[model samples]
Target: MLSRKASCDSHGQDSSYFLGWQEYEKNPYHTVHNPTGIIQMGLAENQLSFDLIESWLRRNPDIVGLKRDGESAFRELALFQDYHGLPVFKNELVDFMAKIRGNRIIFASNKLVLTAGATPANETLMFCLAEPGEAFLLPTPYYPGFDRDLKWRTGVEIVPIHCSSSNGFRITSSALERAYQQAQKLNLNVKGVLVTNPSNPLGITMNRAELNHLIDFAIDKNIHIVSDEIYSGTVFDSPKFVSIMELAMERELYNADIWNRIHIVYSLSKDLGVPGFRVGMIYSNNETVVDTATKMSSFGLVSSQTQFLLASILSDKKFTEKYMKETQRRLKKRREMLVSGLRNAGIQCLISNAGLFCWVDMRHLLTSDTFEAEKELWKRIVCEVGLNISAGSSCHCSEPGWFRICFANMSQETLQVAMQRMKAFTDSSNSAVSQQQFVNNTRARSLTKWVFQLSSYESEPHR
Candidate 1:
């Protein structure tokens, strides 16, 4: 026997979103080997600007050698394993974050707590802010991994604010009120609200009205606001990504008590296409949280080797500037290609402007307007259409027919093959739906006649 935590299925990895990944791995589509096999569009990874990163890495040979200024810094870094992290790395990291936000928000290296990645960064924040069983309110159709990262080991609960597609799933005052009340009914102390600006599933940035409303609600409720901005730099189109700290200053809330309660989780996983490095940060004005999270970083600290490599790369302003611009240009083009391809298949997205994926409406493709139908449609898409995608239900979306289809993980030619497959499937589905409607109508008429005959027989059966 093992500990309950080890044995239990609380990690939430069995969700369909992840299962789709399994499906992709089983029969992956390759342009050369398996052109007709399933093409993976379920992962939110950025492979667009790796060339730039690689070019820089090639030039900076000393980074891997652990040498600075033609000398060795290996021994010092090798022996160093403090939770405080390398100051050079932190300084450069925070400065890089500022560059992503248009040099608008200046992040302090002192207030930043480094973790292995965004996953642990979020879990660490939950540990700092809430006791076990306290809750965080997340909007509907959120990043499904939150189920595990925020709750699995921490024992925190996630209450859905249940934003609707009516207003493009924008967080609303009414939805917030409803969610908070629901949490109250469950007798859970709402510790905070977590949001992903340049939202993971939606690929849409939160407008200022929504941002102000969220901050005000958090202030009124006296709850922490954890803004997960991992995809901050991936924002390729307008309106640009808005850091909560930036907005707080604009509204003069930076000087208020609310600023202390506002925490941001940032990572190079999405922005820098370096998930393997596992570099994540937590920035907060709350000194206690920063210190507590720093202590917690011992469990998932970024390795010194990774810190050095990143420091070298991020310190090169010329490379970072060119990288960001070229990255945006490529992402915008890739996004356009996916959008245009989906349009040819009669599938329209949620008018998203950022992120590596599109939250497109596939409700018309569903057999019925229900989550069950969403699952069925998803199964068909994955199995029959040979495309791996995430259904809205996996994201806790209340509505059906929406899916997150990623575009940045594969080549343009591979994407074209996927689009061709999607177009064929949709065309067939439209015909099948029409034929099924006729079949249903005929079955209804036959059932009515059978009922009349059965009633007449019953009336004479007394003999």
Candidate 2:
């Protein structure tokens, strides 16, 4: 039976106050101290990636930190605008945009270009492009933002192309076809395909050859392509990162299909490891789309300082190359360390090539809802063993039995310690679950009473 706190909302929607006022009040503590946030995984980005900006500042240490209210970074705002033929006082934003007519960067295209970050970019693109009845296909268990961003921002329908543990959570062309076919039968208009290279939760980068097939498919269907290449420069141990832009740029020479229609959205944020800098580029040969996005930007306004800082950084080739290599080296080491730990503990991890995340399967233990398992898992880690991870179910995939671990922010020692804590938590959970099953056997009893039992899992084997 539902408890007094489990009553419906004012709208008669069911809500559960599982924990009392004290536990609810302590929520922020649980979230902030959690390993996912605190453990220093490499996912948060590195300062080394922004060495260019730092170097510039060091050279001009006397420069004032002023809020620049301006229109374009290319001319009036950017440091190297003059080098790129931008006159410091001239209106070169339109001219700079005109130079690149079409873009081929996967994950960084016109359909979904730059916005503070990929999240808003995805939301705006889907909102503007997806018609009232259109369906946007996403890989199951992908990024969480895709689900929340689209839902809260637009009225378009979402059609998930489910990926499963059996396939190692890798999405395939066949899956795309099936989702399209199903949407067609349901009279859903499918307008575009959005895929994340080195996907957020999965960390699986599609092979270039397979990407070509996808491009061909989109071309034939006349669907827009939104490739999230925010992680574009992060691929490790793979063939050099290949983009749809290279192929699209090539194809445009002969086919109207490849012309200024494809869009590319790139950001200095992720690869540069400076999310706070918030500088991203939208490249499109399609004048109509680029013009539309620019108009949108005029209303939204770009921070002049951010633009200048980014332009300064991008102008330095040596600075960019050095940082990129260093970041890759560090991330590679972290990935290996995490993989080794998981393996030693008998947990399975899908190895990723060029990204900061690894998607792990816990379906056997989770069995039901991915989100529910993650919610429980996160709590267990925080209250029990002091470990944390991004719940796999948060990404709006069909499955929630998986969890994603980010390697972008942590030091090696910290990661090892956190992993050990997670291992201990695993043991504690197993022990408590066994005992709780007996307490839950009674039909009339409230099984949730045992949630407190988890505190024992937290306090015992004291860290």
Candidate lDDT (C-alpha), each: 0.93, 0.58
TM-score of 2: 0.72
Instruction: Determine which window of 10 residues in candidate 1 has minimal summed lDDT.
Output: 248-257
Each model's TM-score, in the order given?
0.94, 0.72
Model 1 Cα displacement at 274 (Å)? Answer: 0.6
Highest TM-score against the true fold, candidate: 1
Candidate 2, residues 308-391: lDDT per residue as tens digits? 455444544466567667777876777788888876665778767877777776655552565666567655554455444655
**What's the true lDDT of residue 225 in model 2?**
75
Q: Which ten residues in a row have the lowest lDDT in candidate 2?
A: 12-21
The digit string of per-residue lDDT tens for model 1 on 373-424 reads 9999999999999999999999999998999999999999989999999999
Candidate 1 pairs with clashing backbones: 116-278
